[model samples]
Target: MRTPTCGPLDLAAWLTSDSMANTTSTASEDISELIAVDEQSQDVFVSRSFPQRTGNTLRIGYGGCTTAVMIQAVCKTVQPQYQLFSFLGSFLGPTSIDHKIHCRVARTRDTRSLASRVVYAFQILENGSERVCAQASADFHVPEPALYTYSIPLPTIDGDGPEDEHHAPSARTLLSRGIEDGHITSSSANSYFTNFHLMDQYFDWRHCLTSTSTQTLLSLAPHLPTTHDSKPLTARPQIEYIRLKCRLPTPSANWAALAFYMDGGLSFLPLHLDHKSLEDAGACSTLDFALRVVETRGMDFGAWHLRERRTMAAAGGRTLSEGWVWDGEGRVVATMSQTGILRPRGEGKGRGKL
Candidate 1:
């Protein structure tokens, strides 16, 4: 739990420059500001030269990145006294790394201790055409003392690297990379994830999936779990540790970063469950997502957090996945759930290239 650098967000000062909108960009300034909402007007905000966090260079923007941006857009407009507690949204269209999304926030509810807002994310394309890529609702609240607190223990991951200030891949990445490096099987990598595309790792099977306390395994889920309990490839929750690449300069930036990481791992989870990668899918894209903040006292960008993901169910050309985020002290930082399309490779219809 690192402390965020001090200062109230001065989004206006950063907006004076037009170069802040460039899609192909980076900055020496705090990466926090780079990812913060670029306020355009009272209700509108655009990305401020935010570094694209795509797994592939395609027309479809990363749902998690867009979700992070949309959440921050509303966070910018809300009073500083309130903090985000819950968020829900749906992807109605597509977006990409080559575009900048404009988020418009509409206040739907307000009170002294609580507030609610709805956000619409529109991606401005190269030809100046804007499409509604996503829409979401966010709820924020003033701090309140907890009556009682309890959370499931932070399950120990196998030889999980020591926590660092920054620089670590998520659990999903380790699992995918393990498969690609020949731990699970020599299958092609998922086309939708940056992790699945990488061909290297420094760990063996024993380093990632087994221990004495609990036998939590990060293996592939069988296609028919209900009828295949006796099979070795049963559905089990996956665990991995992740951290931001650098420290953010403000509280608002931390929230956006949390959201960005939370929205990830869903698109490729279904494929992983069925021993398939995005390369074996026809449609694999997120349709909707939800996030609930459980605790935030010391949730900082530069600390390692565990993301546990598993498919709740998969059928009828769709899949529902759930994840839990736990801090080093076993605190529940937040909980997330997502629903998306997951068609077989030959179906050749819907969104996502795999």
Candidate 2:
């Protein structure tokens, strides 16, 4: 299948087309570039470039991208010692990629060891109207001695993992590789289940021993969740390796990159476990997210890390997915949770980040 190319200048042309692809640059982007926000005034910030939309051409703005930028914008107003520890937010409405974004930061609280910030993002429309797109509450904390420490062990898996020769820089790389092998159409993006025009340049992901079944979440004994939370196989688990395509200049930039990376495949984790794709669903979109960075010492976006995710629940027109990221040595680095709308087609509901 053929997918259309959209360089930086392709926005105008994309806005006029009847397509489900985003008007996003096909060229790869670094995390710093994607999160770079220009200070407009005391606490307000503006985008240096248009915030990117997800692969879904239906114009679903990437919720993670907005969250990442919000985190960065908040970082600018906080003390250097206080790093982001927690963030809770929701996508307020759909966003247009054709316009720049403006962020307003509110200093909610400030103390010696802790700081709180509330951030709101708005799309600066062509007509000069500003519409609220997303909002988030972030907490920053200075490094402190741990009073107690404990973490679940990484699951053991039986299969060729990401270290094998079959891995690529991103998950979608496998989809494109299919085109090279003539297994899929090389010309049209329409033939694919999802689009990755913008994300292919930001991060690399390597999948490992992916499976879903009863008894074992992946149906493998070694790969069971070792936590006390495990209740006789309640969810499907997926494992992958991830790293940024380029180094982020600051620790704050690295944190934002993790925010973006963790948002992947969340709204559709259920479909993924069913061995299905977006083609099997009417529409899916993340409604809310909560993230907590466990440690502030190792802020390395350029290094490889292990990421594991599981579907916590799916019901009542929404689904929840939880994820954990760990350093190469198996130390827990961060945790992310998302709830989203997922349903069959013909529901008459619109599709996009909201």
Candidate 3:
């Protein structure tokens, strides 16, 4: 991959240029700090070689490459000209942080209204072997006249900002909801398990199902739900309000951001269905993710998106879940589905802990 000269130092100059003055309404200084060049959240024109990999806890030297980031890298190549309407990606393997990811795009099909492109991501091993980490095919469409449009009703849920004062649910909300759904039990004092939301720094999530009531500090750890005399029902569909900490420039960028957001948390739907905790649930990772853009008429990055995720099926160590993203006004933004692998802990041992 060839590196681009538009680094952070050149960003200010790009923003003040006459070209940008005609594009953005918001001032450069007023822009959200969440914008990153390689991430494609802004309009500053970042290229392929811009750094994407960052530090990871694991010393494998390969940094984490998120599904969303990889998708964004591909979408940016055709942004503005054609907005991404659909994407299907397969995560083949993990890449090291030490090596830069190389994205290769190929135009597969095109017509007057729609176009398709295939993307492949690869990382060079220390031994100089190029390992394929992800492959994706995205369909884009040009703006055209539509005769009719409709969207299914969104489940009743609270959103962030304005009257709500940006109070999205913390990790405690997940534990509370898990308990209410009979999927989680309170952990014993000896259990070192804790809510992971305390470490969250980006998106704010408001879990509508369990947010109506408050939870105690002692109530936050994962525990096995108790059984009833009669067989318990399956876990309810999980719903939450997810909002980005920063805003992006275009609709394509927003969609890319949504891709990143859905890749996380949604995969746990299967564990919720089986009433299992992270420690006992075994190892889990997203194998593939597919997203469809239902309508983009009024998609806004600044507004809170209602994300409703539910498991469709799970068997043979694999799980499938569907997630819907809607804007604050109830306009459906996008629908996402993911397939994940769940290996039950024990049996032997796995690389992923809890």
Candidate 4:
């Protein structure tokens, strides 16, 4: 990969720009000093700024943008084949783009092959409010020397010549204009994830079922009578449930990979299935999810069908686990594990399919 222009001079210029812009914000009152320079020992630099916000709710937009920029800068310096494997962030208090924010990175380990780092993103509001908007620890694996190699075959797809093939529109396309365009040309009145989604030529995904149908079944099931219309039943009937799965394929890259085993179980029912009526009636939540990386194939982007999905276990308001596999062409490939929380939809929703 090409190196990014992020030397000491470039860093200085970036900080200067930030400092100049800060003069007009409310944070300027609280910021007694602003400074950023390279740290030779760790081969990293620190950027500090002051911010001001009214309440304790950190602005998610500014936080995400700042975090992305900070990560990109550090990665450019470290030059790791870095991928966003996992992210866990929370808003502790209100923050402003102009507030005094300090980004500090520390190298935790450096071996012959791999390196790890911890990043702390701190914010100080004008009202003497301090918060840590994001903190992350990441590990980078060194690239191994290539030797003998083997790979699974790519998946098969019907021929509709590449030019005539009908490609499904991705959520990115449906929501934002291409990155080249600076405006939000698409409708913003959509689901949060759909509005700010990630799309890569590196993977292919397909939906096996509609969200509406799944929601309907989940909503109506609890209301169904345990016994016949008029009969008094001794035992309550068991609820029937189905697992929905999506198939994924690896895109052609040196390393074909996929983020598998996302802990959707936590959010699966409350976020997607549970309804207000059921919550009010004191119905128990369902815990059911399982995913496994089945096979590995050669690095390539090809069509892969979701074979089947079944609930492996469900008990005590907690789903066991879910697994996902990426097929490189025809052979099974990479995998990942993830955990999520169910919450009301924020800004992006119902805009487009993932």
Query: Backbone collision count in every prediction?
Result: 4, 11, 7, 35
Estimate, for each residue in 219-284, the C-alpha lDDT of model 3 and write its tens digit: 233233322113322234566667766667777557756775666555666555444545555567
Ranking by lDDT: 2, 1, 3, 4
TM-score of each: 0.74, 0.80, 0.69, 0.39
Task: Give me the runs in candidate 3 sitting further than 4 Å from their true place.
Answer: 1-65, 158-199, 211-219, 224-235, 273-275, 352-354
Count of clashing pairs, candidate 3: 7
In terms of lDDT, the poorest run of 10 residues in model 2 is 1-10
The sequence of per-residue lDDT tens digits that candidate 2 reaches over residues 147-178 is 97767787665544555635322344554554
Question: Residue 44 of model 2: what lDDT?
Answer: 88
Best by TM-score: 2
lDDT of 4 by residue, 70-150 (tens): 343244344544332333333232234454445567666667666666665555444443455455554555545557544
Q: What lDDT does candidate 3 reach at residue 179? A: 61
Model 2 scores a TM of 0.80
lDDT of 1 by residue, 1-354 (tens): 111121222223222335435546422244455456678888888986543535444434456667778877898778988889999988876554455677888898889999999888876544455567788889999988878889988765545354321223444454456565554443323432343221112111121232210111133322313322343322555555666657776667777778777776676775555545566777677888888888758467577677777778777888889888887787889889988887776554634332
After TM-score superposition, the amount by which residue 193's alpha carbon in candidate 3 deviates from its true location, in angstroms, is: 12
Q: List candidate 4 segments past 4 Å from native.
A: 1-59, 62-74, 80-102, 127-130, 145-206, 210-270, 275-354
TM-score of model number 1: 0.74
Alpha carbon deviation, residue 148, candidate 4 (Å): 11
